[model samples]
Target: MNFSGKIEYWEQSTNGTWSLFAVNPSDNFSVYNFCGKFGSCNLNDNKLPCKCLPGFMPHVPQKWYSGDFSDGCTKNLMSCGDTFLNLKMMNIGRKPEQSHQVGNETECKELCLKNCDCSYTYDEKSCLIWTQELVNLQEEYVEGYNLSIRVAISDIEPTVQNCEPCGTNMIPYPLSTSSNCGDPMYFSFNCNTTSGQVSFKALGGTYRVASIYQNTSKFFIQVMDVGSLRLNQSLPFNLTTPRNSSSNVSSRVTDDVEIVWEPPLEPLCNLPADCKD
Candidate 1:
């Protein structure tokens, strides 16, 4: 079925019956899904499918509420430092004006920050940076790359000093043993020694501190099984399981699981900071 502003394309299903492919200009499909610049489209939101990106507000609130987002959004506030907010599983439908082959994501971020024209940066196998206004951005539930959006420094909170050790595990500076030690939301750690094994109090199971990456604000943890992975509160970090060197379960079961936690791209402290945390 086709209409003046919408199209319903059909496709053959695996069972050999014609099925509805998609409906353009509806919730699922559109040529300009997000409506305008700096707008993000989400099909899950029925009433308001389009939303302004972080640090941004609707350019015209009345137009936006009336289901007309042609004007898009503008920045709400400005801050001191250069920061980028991560938008996961988003489809930004445009090629970046410039691209670079960097060593890693960290390097890619640094390069983007140095260039004032760069507005967005993406990292997969290579790094791609965009200088133009972002348009037609759509969110997907699964299978997408992370797009880091640049913002100001005043928006970010500073980190606190909270480096302490529980047993043999040394909790890093940003990670504290108590509530008063580190940044309350971003850098808090709990240590439990009741079981004679050192473990993160927030994380239920016992784990051994393997290594800490201060520059990246990340840490490696060794545990017996992957099932024990749990965090007491939500923080701006990505937890991933690293590959085990040994395949023998009996020989290396206790040391099989390795968890790597990565902080956000933005620094929790001011520039020229030390690696103590």
Candidate 2:
């Protein structure tokens, strides 16, 4: 017997009547990066299935508004800097170009920063780094992994201003935890009262904030040992300060985290012979 449609499978019953057997629904979503770079496809959304990531605007708004998402998105020019935005519970649909087993989350961030092409970093059991334009990012509401995209500090919305200082170092507007201090967008940071050190919290782990530069919008954090991976922490939530007020916080040697520096956007030479000219 012939089936009416390609997706429906029919099998003959014992009595001789043919009935529906199984359906292969793979046709619904067979294309990868169907929404293009920086565009997230929402299977739940039928009317407008594609959306741009936070801090991103459609590369061609006209095309996006017209329901053509091939152009994807582009970073806001005014928002260029060295901070990061945490997109939790997401399906990054593509495998990273580089994967390494690092000591902790900070090392992953540092590794990505060292590569100018690196766009984002994901740390679970291993540190995963992606380079160039990212594509096929989907929001998996349930049982999804955490992703941190490199963004400018200005890209994050400001809630608290003139935050209280974290010891000798000052806590900038978007990196503070005190209500008096800010990224209502879930920029989680912790200030240690006893040790007087400020820490930045991420899915991979936590790291110490070495310094913050307001003029250039840059941050230097020190990577710590990976004791725990806080995978269960809810997204868009603040990390409460440690209750213990003692000064016995153990000190460990950490590598310096420099995420602001980047390589030249364009190659210096097209070929080896071009260098001679």
Candidate 3:
């Protein structure tokens, strides 16, 4: 059932072995610390986890001593002049209620500065600032992204909530990733969610992103290319794996995502008859 190296072919007439190796491995560069999970804690738990962000002090250090990081390593929310200090390449975190991404260190700071709700950052790539209490904090496993939350600044970005992307010459992509329906291309955000951010009702539709929003109120969605999307139509599409193909996805959205299709796996691209003209 398994190959030894590279899979050359799969034929019913003959049995052959196939093996695979990953050319790009992120595992070689992983750094984990319990303090990062504590949010306030540094690398070692030995130090007091109650330390506040730079330019601020703890609201109640005694409570944090009792394993209550929920006190949120308090900071001076009233501070006006405080800006972000970029810890280069440091691993920051993603907020559950907030949406953001990593951009240039200066842009990350500016992004937070634009919004009074945004305050600080811990890393250049994975920046983290705080306006509210930093709770349920955990060490982010994926290549962390940076975000300056808020200290006390006016709206930074051109958008109202500082929600729109701040930097990147070609338009920075959102971390909320998914594949483009019908095209088999992965998409993070397009015209849809951008519209939704302004008006909650604008985006929830037959599109896969809307499909997820309809079921889960959490509002985290990225339409993937795992299904055939019938434009302007609402119909249940079944995802099936080919006879021996490992790619497959279940129709039920709640179940694990099926690896419905692969690019090279499909027959060599022959244009649909209508496109030939």
In Å, residue 3's CA in model 1 sits off its true spot by 6.8
lDDT of the candidates, in the order given: 0.57, 0.57, 0.32
Model 2 Cα shift for residue 86 (angstroms): 0.6
Residue ranges of candidate 2 with Cα displaced over 4 Å: 1-30, 44-47, 78-80, 120-125, 141-143, 158-277
Candidate 1 lands at a TM-score of: 0.48
Total backbone collisions for each predicted model: 3, 0, 30
Tens digits of per-residue lDDT for model 3 on 1-277? 2243322433342355543433222121222222222243322111122233333344556655565444444444555655442221124443543335677566556655665545455454654455544433322223533334443322122112112321110111111232312222223234332212211111223332211211222222222333432222122222333122121222223222221222212222354631322
* Model 3: CA > 4 A from native: 1-39, 43-50, 88-93, 96-108, 119-133, 136-142, 145-277
For model 2, give the 10-residue run with minimal summed lDDT: 241-250
**Model 3: ten consecutive residues of lowest lDDT:** 166-175
**Tens digits of per-residue lDDT for model 1, 1-277:** 4656677888998899998867765543365645688787654332235667655668899998797888887666644237776665667767787778877888888877876535555556488888777877776535545677676533322333534334223355456567655555544345544311233433566455444445556665555566656765466455666545342212433443334454434334453443333
Q: What is the model-wide C-alpha lDDT for candidate 1? A: 0.57
